[model samples]
Target: MTHVVTESCINCKHTDCVEVCPVDAFHEGPNFLVIDPDVCIDCIACVAECPVAAIYVDSDVPASQRQFLALNAELARDWPVIVRKREPLPDAAHWADVTGKIDHLQHP
Candidate 1:
């Protein structure tokens, strides 16, 4: 199973996980990051790096956030690959623990 970047990642866009991904499976969006399922190695390296705890194995994604699996897949196809860690959004700390931010996700 692949890891999915869930709603908690929206607007926060922490890239710590990106740096740990062995396959460079992460894709960058305007305010989010998604893992390309086809490229993820199921290594689980990104999960612990996420300060917001937003990365989950596809099988472990909460039912409420299940849609993220498809969302990650769909967006990864178009977003540019992100291989380096970058500063998170300026408001990341403010948004990190906030719940239900799906509508705030920014696509590019």
Candidate 2:
């Protein structure tokens, strides 16, 4: 199973999890991050490092944010490897831009 980056991550865009992921499975999102299910290895290194506790195994994803499970897989197919992820402050000031954008970025 894959890990899901939940809505909690929307404003809590800390990138430390990305820093520890070994497979380069993490991808950039407008206000958060997405994990590549195919490459994740279910290592869960990202989950423990997430300060806000935004990451979860797919089966444990909260009902409201289930869409992210699909979003991750869809985005993974095309997301580039992140060579140097950095810690980021909460994007509370700019989260208005994240809504509905994932629907437009699909996997080929």
Best by TM-score: 1
The C-alpha stretches of model 2 lying farther than 4 A from their native spots are: 90-108
**Candidate 1 pairs with clashing backbones:** none
Per-residue lDDT of candidate 2, residues 21-101 (tens digit):
888788876556788888888888889887767799999998877888987787666667564666574554464345544
The deviation in Å at residue 91 for candidate 1 is 0.4
Which candidate gets the maximum lDDT versus the true structure? 1
Return the lDDT, model 2, position 89. 49
Task: Give the Cα error of residue 59 in candidate 1, in Å.
Answer: 0.2
TM-score of each: 0.97, 0.75
Show how many residue pairs clash in every candidate, following the order shown.
0, 0
> Candidate 2 has which clashing residue pairs, if any?
none
Candidate 1: how large is its RMSD? 0.8
